[model samples]
Target chain A: MKLWVSPRAPSPRRVLMFIAEKGIGDVELASVEIGRGEHRSAAYLARSPLGKVPVLELPDGRALGETRAICSYLEGRHPEPNLMGIGFEEHAFIEAADRRVEFYLLGTIANWIRHGHPGLAPLEQPQFPDFSAAQGRKLREVAGWLDGELQRQDWVAGKRFTIADITAFCALEFARGLMKFRPADEGFEALQAWRDRIAARPSAKAGA
Target chain B: MKLWVSPRAPSPRRVLMFIAEKGIGDVELASVEIGRGEHRSAAYLARSPLGKVPVLELPDGRALGETRAICSYLEGRHPEPNLMGIGFEEHAFIEAADRRVEFYLLGTIANWIRHGHPGLAPLEQPQFPDFSAAQGRKLREVAGWLDGELQRQDWVAGKRFTIADITAFCALEFARGLMKFRPADEGFEALQAWRDRIAARPSAKAGA
Candidate 1:
């Protein structure tokens, strides 16, 4: 499989980090230059209709897009050190946690950065600062909520450092890079501590 | 298990339709009135921190939030009518399809409605018409893309009517109800036909 990636983007980085965590060795990496509009090219769009990055092209030439979907494929292929969960019940809870962080935190950060940052003006046309400001507030609210969760548990999902942590960490790191956001600055001590801990992992350094 | 739902909302309706599709009868229903702010009540918030509807409370009293996660749990329990998929590759592709429609279509429609509709002012503070307009444009783009897909295939994902169809159908239905969107009116014949097919299903009437 060839994984088409744009390392700079948070979504692609999530899949790359997941691969690093699993120590998957079979897949090959092919970079797509977003600045050059490579992802929008006909060839690339054939693989990913939406022109998104981190598309896993299978051996038969079929491609699987979406970060979570790609990660799910990897988890199914390489089951060791499982980041999702074991049983049906565990899977539901873990997925619920992952979706929570993905939708509320990462998604909010994406909206804020896309609308607030001038650098993203080309990608997100006619940026709206007021809308971005609303998302920014929502992001901080979710970050604080996450901090409360971390205060009670060791991982974002629950007892284990599951895929939920990878999602939340990637979201936080994206904000750190583009929005210059830090949970510590906002008095979210537990969330900041959790971020520090995750940053120390080898997988966190993947494609950085 | 008890499924907490607010049928008036799209997210909860997704789960409701899933239940009808699976023919699962063991799960009980408990309604939460969103208009009455019951979803924001302390008890509901404890079940779902995000306070979203359609939370599946397990027999042990543990709650599983997130529509997809709840559906996954139900799928695992009742695998006969397999809405997800059987194996890893299929799971990845199906999920990829599901996510595409979800993030691009449903999510965009949500942004447009929440920010543009005056009735949603209480839920989405400080509405941004410009941002909502952008999302409306994005929604049309995605809808056209989906119409193209349906032109080539029988279902949203592929040959089968998987969970992807469920998501796409729900998204289109929501747009139809809220935004007065009609794919046929825009010359998206394939998409309109597919929507009609799904609308004819008994599951489509599970909530509405």
Candidate 2:
């Protein structure tokens, strides 16, 4: 199998970092340039109808998009050093935690970028700064909530590092593209410590 | 196990409908009235940190939130009917399709409601009508895309009905709650037919 990736994007970075942590090998990578509109080409759209990056193409020529789905497929194929979870309820709980961060925090960050950042004007037409400001408030609120969770646990989901940690990790890093952050000043010292710890891992440097 | 749900909501309805589809009989139901802010109760927050509905409380007293994760747990415990997928690749592909509809179509519909609907103003503070209008355009565009796909496949994901169909079904219904819909006039005949089919199922009425 091979993967089409835009290494610069947060979605693809999540999958790449996941692959690194799992010690996945043998999957080939083909780069797609988002700035060049490579992902919008008919050929690429045929693989991913939504024209997004980080598509995993199976041997039979079928491709899969969506970062979590791709990562779940890897979990299915590899099943070692499992980042999803161990028990039945554990997996379900971890997934719930992961999706909470994905749907709220990550999406809030995207809104800030799409509507607030001038650099994204071409992609987000007729941007709305007021809407972005609302999303920014949500980001800070969500960050404050997560700070408490981080203060309690080593990992976002539970006792050990799981997909929840990886998802929050990616979202927090991608947040930097929108604005420079000061975790301590924001009263997110626990989040800062967690981020620092994850950044030290070899998997964090596996982007591209 | 028991579930906390507000059947009127889209996310909770997804889980209830899925349980109906799978003939899950044993799980008990405990309603959470969102209109009354019952979800924000300290007891509810202890189970679901995010204070959302469709939380499945295990026999061990631990609860898991997020509609998809709750459904996934049910799928894991009872693997009959095989709603997730038959193989690793199939699962990934199905999930990709599900997420496509989810992240784009459902989310767009949600934006329209959150930002445009007067009833949601309290939940979505400082709502922006301009952003909602843009998101409305996206909802229509995504509906056009899905109309074509529904014409080709029996279900949203592929040949067999799956979780993807359930998600889209809930989203379309939720859209109507926000505004009246005329599928034929809107040129969404295929989507209308698909909705009708899913509505015919005994599971569809299990929302409450």
Candidate 3:
């Protein structure tokens, strides 16, 4: 199986981190250059209908595009040291946690950076400064909430590290790199600490 | 177990339809008036941290939020006539399909309507017409692509009806109601046909 990835993108990094966390190997990596519009090429479009990066091409030659889906598939394939939950109940809670981070935190950061960053203008179609600013404010609100959650629990999901942590870490990393965002600077010490802890993980540097 | 729901909301409706599809009748329904600001009440916030609709209160009194998570939990509990998928491979394919519909179709429609519609002014913090217009155009582009996909497959996730269909149907229904969008009117016959087929299902009117 081959994994099509764009090195600089966040979603592809998610799959890479998951693979590393699970200690999975033997998967071939194919790079797609987003800057040069390689992802928009006819062959790439056939692989990922929406022209997104980080598509997992199955042994049967089918392309699976969603980051969460690709990770879930990998988890199902390699269940040792599971990053998703064990049972139905745990699955529900972990998924809820991941969705919360994905929707409010990561989703907000992506929207804010995409619309606000000058470097992303080619990708955003047309930048909306006001909307981007609104998303920025919303991101801070959600980040503050996340900081509180981290204070109450060790991982993004709960006591144990999971896919949710990978998601949140990647999101904050993106913000730190592009938005120059820092939780500690905004009085979110707990979040900053959590970020530091995750960054120490070998998987954190996966595909960096 | 009680399901907290707001009737007019798309996310809540997604859960309702899933319940109906699964033929699960033991679950009790609790209403939250979103228009009356009841969802913002402290009591409601305790049940759902983000105050989003369609929260499932477990028998142990834990509130499980996020529509997909809730549905997955229910699917785990009731496996007959599965909506997610059968195995890891099918699950991956189905999830990829669902994410495509959710992110491109439903997400775009929600953004467009939230910023464009007058009645939604209360929900959207500050409306941006340009962003709304951009989202509307993106919605059309996605819907057109979905129309082409439907021309090739019978269901949203292909072959059998699944959660992806439910999600796509809810999204299209929301557009039909709020945006006055008709796939056929916009020259998307396959999408219109698929919509009509799903509408004929008893689950389509489950919560409505």
Candidate 4:
């Protein structure tokens, strides 16, 4: 199976981080240049209807989009040292936590960049500074909330390191690059520490 | 196990439709009054940090939020009729299709409602009319894309009926109530027919 990804993308980094965590090195890689509008080409659209990066091409020639779905699929095939979850209940909670980070933290950052960043002006039809600023405020608010949550638990979904952590790490990293968001200065002591711990992982740098 | 949901919610309705399809009647039901802000109570917040409904409370006191997660968890435990998928490869594609509906069609509709609907004024602080209007246009654009996809297939995710159908059904139903969007009137003949077919299922009404 070949993985279609853009090195600069956040979503593709998610899949890469997961693969690095699993210590899997055999998967082939095919880069899609997002900067040149390669992802919007007809060839890329055939693989991903949304024409987005980070698609996994199955051996059967079927392409799979969405980072979570592809990660879960990999988890299903490679069950050992499980990163998603262990059983039904664990999977449910982990997914819930993952979605929480996604909908609140990651979603806010994404909206900010898509609508606020000048570099992406060509991508978003009509950029809205007001809307982008609103999302930025949401980012700060959600970050504060996450700081409190991290004050209580070690990981986003309790003890073990999971996909939830990976998501937050990548999202926060993206925020750092796009919005100049610094967790420590934002009064997110716990979250800042968690970020450092997650960043120290070999996969974190390997994927980058 | 107990299911906490609001009758009028779109996400909760997705889980309900899935339960209806699975013919699972033994699950206990608990209603959260979102209009009255029952979901924001201390008790509910303890279960769900986001203070949203449609959480599946496990017997062990674990509460699972996110409709897809709960539905997938249930599918993991039940594994009959194979609504999610039959195997690893199938599961990946079904998930890919599900996320596509979620990120594009459903996400746009939800944003338009949350940001534009006056009934939700209490929920979304300082709503932006311009942004909301932008999302509304996106709703129309994505609906048109879906109409084209449905023109060639019997179901949302290719030929087989899956959870993707339930998600789109609930999402479009929400739009119908909120926006009065009639697929037939808008030249979405294929999508209109698909909606009717999904609505005819016994499970569609059972959970609703």
Candidate 5:
């Protein structure tokens, strides 16, 4: 199997981290340069109509896009270190948490970056006129919410180190690069510690 | 099991259609009026922090949000009439297609509606200030893309009806209430006919 990825992308990073956690290094990597607009090319579009990255091309040549779907497929195929969940309720919990992180945290962060960062202006149409202010506010709001959620748990999905953690961790890290996380905020103590712990994972370092 | 849903929200409609498709009426329905801001209550937030509707509370008191996840859980519990897929590769294909419909079609449409509609002005605060115009353009782009994709297949996931089709059909119907599909647009004939056929389904009628 070959994974088509872009190094600078958050979605592809999620997949790389999952592959690292699975300890599957035998898979080939096909790099797509997003800055060069390679993802919009016809060849890449054949693999993904949305022209996004982190597309997994199976041995049979069929390509699977979507970071979550690809990750889910890998989890099903290699169930040793379960990233999704072990049982039905666990699965549901992990999925619910995962969606929460995606829609709430990651989605907000990505939109902020896409709309705020001048470097990404060309990628999105009709550039957001008030990018910086909007993004700053969104980032603060999302971080506050995520930090509050993290304060009550050891991980994103309660106890386990599931995909929800990975999703949230990746997004949080991505946000940290663009903006500073308020360490003084009482709500984020657990979240800050969790970030450090997750960052120390072998897979996290390897994927990076 | 009980489903917490709203009357006009598309996400709940997805689950309602799934329930109707599976002929499962044992699940009770609980309504939440989104327009009246019932979903924003502290009680509702405890159920789903995102404050979205279509939360399926299980018999065990665990709630599952996100339409696809709820559908997957339902499919797992009721596997006789499978809506996901039959085999591994089929599952991958269905999931991939479902994600495409979700991210590209439904996601875009919802963004357009929530951000663009004056009726939803309260919800557009920090996320989108002038969301309507951008959302309108996004909705058109996705509809055009779906039209092209539909030209090459019988269903959204090829050969059989799956969750992808359900999501797309519901999204398209929802879009119709917002903006009409342009029949004059070339290559949308198949999509138009397909829409008519799916709209005729008893499940579609019953859920709507």
Candidate 6:
């Protein structure tokens, strides 16, 4: 199997970290330069119509796109180090938390980065005219919510290290380059500690 | 298991359709009124800190929020009529298509409706001052993309009926309230037929 990825993209990093954590070694990486618009090339488009990075091409030539979907596939294919959870209730809890991180946290962060960062404005297009103010407000709101949630749990999905933590950690770390973390924010102690723990993971460092 | 849902909300309707499709019984429905802002109530907040509707409260009192996650849980527990897919590859295909519909198509439609429709402005902060133009552009872009995709395949994720179809169909139908379908749009013949077929399903009608 070959994984088409971009070095700097958050979505691709999510998959790479999963690969590392799962200790999957039969995969090859084909890097695409997003800055050069390599993802939009005809070759890449055949693999992913959306022109997004992190497209996984199977041995049979079938290609799968989307980070979470790829991660889900990996978890299913390699069930020993279960990232999705084992039973019905656990599955529900992990998925619920994962969706929350994606829809609420990561979605907000993406909107912020797309609308706020000067470099990304052209990519996001006409919906976001003045990206700075809109992006800033969204970032602050998302961070506040995430900090609160982290304070109440040992991990993003509760006591276990699940895909929710992966999603949140990737987004939070990505946001650091664009938005400053408020160290003095209330209920962020646990979040800070959690961040350090996640960062120390061998998969995260290797993936980065 | 009890499903906490709200009438007139498309997210909850997705869950309703999943339940009906799977022939899963013994699941009770608990209504939460979004119009009255009951989703933000203290009790509901405890169930879902995000305070969103369509939360599935397990028999053990633990609640699962997010429509996709709840549907996923249902699909996992009752795997006979699988809404996700069969095996690893099929699962990835369905999930990839599902996420595409959610992030690109559904995201655009919901943004258009929430920001464009005067009725939904209060639900989320009305950031986009010019509602109509933004929403109109978003609708056109999303519908055109969907029409193109539907023209090529029997179902969203290939030959089989999956959650991708459910998500896309729900989003398209929900958008009908705001945007009219252009029958004249090129390559939409298959989409029109597919829409009708999905509408004929007992689950769709029941959910509606």
User: Which residue runs of candidate 5 sit more than 4 Å off their true CA positions?
Assistant: A181-187, B126-131, B181-187
| Share of reference contacts kept by candidate 4 | 0.69
Q: Model 1: what TM-score?
A: 0.98
lDDT of 4 by residue, A1-208 (tens): 8999887678999999998888776679999887788989999989887787789997788788999999988988777678888877688779888988988899999999989999888778788888898889889889988988899999998889999999999999988887788999978899999999998888898457
| Model 3 per-residue lDDT tens digits across residues B1-208 | 8999887789989999999999998899999998899988999999888788889999889999999999989999998789999988798889899999999999999999999999899899899999999999998899999999999999999999999999999998888898899999999999999999999999999766
What TM-scores do the predictions have?
0.98, 0.96, 0.99, 0.95, 0.93, 0.93
> What interface RMSD do all candidates show, one decimal each?
0.7, 1.2, 0.8, 1.6, 2.4, 2.3
Lowest lDDT 10-residue stretch of candidate 1 chain A: A118-127
Residue A182 accuracy (lDDT) in model 3: 94
Expressed as tens digits, the lDDT of each residue in B14-69 for candidate 1 is: 99899999999998999998877898999999998888888998999989999999
CA displacement after TM-score superposition, residue A5 of candidate 4 (Å): 1.2
Q: How well does candidate 3 reproduce the true complex, by DockQ?
A: 0.84
Looking at model 5 chain A, report the run of 10 residues with the lowest lDDT sum: A179-188
What are the runs in model 1 whose C-alpha is more than 4 Å off? Answer: none
Q: Among all windows of ten consecutive residues in candidate 6 chain B, which has the lowest summed lDDT?
A: B178-187
User: lDDT by residue for model 6 over A26-136, one digit each (tens)?
Assistant: 889999987778987998989998787799998898899999889888887788688888876687788888888887767777777766677775456654644335655
DockQ of each: 0.89, 0.78, 0.84, 0.69, 0.51, 0.63
Error of 6 at A186 (Å): 6.9
Docking class of 6: medium
Candidate 4, B153-189: lDDT as tens digits: 8888887999999999888888888888778988889
Best by DockQ: 1
lDDT per residue for candidate 1 within A1-208, as digits (tens), equals: 9999886789888998999999999989999998788989999999999899989998898889999999999999999899998988899899999999999999999999999998888788889999899899999889989999999999999999999999999999999999889999999999999999999999999867
Per-residue alpha-carbon lDDT of model 2 for A1-208, expressed as tens digits? 8988885677888998999999989788899988778888999989988788789997787788899999989999998999987766677888888998898888888888778888778768889999888788889988988889989889888699888888888888878655775566688999899988998999988663
Give the range of the ten consecutive residues with the poorest summed lDDT in model 5 chain B: B178-187
Candidate 5 docking DockQ: 0.51
For model 2, how does the per-residue alpha-carbon lDDT over B1-208 read when each residue is reduced to its tens digit?
Answer: 9998885788988898888888989999999988788888999999988787889999888888899899879988988888888777787878888898888888989998889889888767788988888888888888998998989989999899999998998888888877665456698999998989888988888773
